[model samples]
Target: MRLLLVEDDTRLAEFLAQGLAEAGFVVDTVAEAGDAEAALDTVPYDLLILDLGLPDGDGMDLLARLRARGEMLPILVLTARGALADRVSGLNRGADDYVLKPCATEELVARAKALLRRPGGALGAVLILGNLRFDTLAMECAMENRPLDLSRRELAVLETLLRRAGRVVPKRVLEEKVYGFDDSVASNSIEVHISRLRRKLEAEGATVRVHTLRGIGYMLSEEK
Candidate 1:
């Protein structure tokens, strides 16, 4: 999944972005509301983590503006404001959830995952296909109840394919999901990960298969 983090605090932004990336998300961070709004206009992010205070404007206005424009992407507010009224105000402005600052990255990641599981979101806590079972939160995968060992990148690739099970996922979309914007990637990197994933699944006797559509993308489906 891709995430946009709108935070002015450099250290906190780095910490959260690193944590979210480790948890299989591609995160882009912007320090001000203008940059954040620009980023939002271009990227189709799965979630947004916003800080309440910005150098140029209040986060409330940004939240309200997005909601008013019918932007339904899940928004999570991460701020130091813990007052009852502040929380209520955030919810009223269309923030899906609120998290106080000085929080553990683990807790923040967990909360973000929960919001992604809401109705209309692309994620499920656990994704299943044939004999394959993947727990996105735990980052675990199993085939027929036996653990399927995979590298983090491989796991991410599999997760994307599983989520869109029968539909073709474009190669460009896969690249965006598996890598952050700043990361330099080789042209064939996605293919390498897909190749490794296919071998692992075949070796494990999984009933699901990943089919490649040359010049287009890939799809995951159960063998007939």
Candidate 2:
């Protein structure tokens, strides 16, 4: 899933980004609250990892604004504050969860998974398109009763398509979903991945179709 991490500490941001990436998350790191806003406006992220202290402003204000605007994005507060009032305040201010700094990476990842497993999040564990099924938590793709061998990028592409099956997913949207804001996506990167995914699905006897509309984008549909 795609996550936006708002952190001001360069070292902490880099460390968390690397760990989260290795854990199969598409993460974008922003050091300031204003940049975080811009990132949110540009990319559709599944969750937010927010540090309360930002360079431009308090992350609390951003959290409140997002909540006021009726955003249901799951937020995990990551900060150095670890007091009863601080924790309570963070929760009361609309954070889904809170984690103090100097904690283990595994614990942070576990909390993230817990949030994603919530009712309105990317949970229920799986998404289905025709004979193809994807286990979101496990990051597994299968056709009928057979497992398909797919690269991480291929899996990411499949997930994006399956999430919006039968609707045209814009190329730009796919790029943001597949690669982070800091990563450079080539002009034909998505097309190349989609082509490889199509072949893999067909090879595994999946009846799902990935259709490309010239100049538009792509759609996943089941063959009748």
Q: Number of the top candidate by lDDT? A: 1
Per-residue lDDT of 98-175 in model 2, one digit per residue for the tens? 999987888888889899999888655889988988988778888886899988778888888888889999998888
Question: Residue 209 of model 2: what lDDT?
Answer: 92
Tens-place lDDT digits, model 1, residues 14-121:
998999888878899998888888988987889999998999999999999999999999999999999999999999999999999889999988889999888998
Error of 2 at 63 (Å): 1.7
TM agreement with the true structure for every prediction: 0.94, 0.93
Candidate 1 local distance difference test against the native: 0.91
Error of 2 at 166 (Å): 1.7
Cα lDDT over the full model 2: 0.89
Backbone collisions counted per model: 0, 0
Clash pairs, model 2 backbone: none
Q: Which residue pairs clash within candidate 1?
A: none
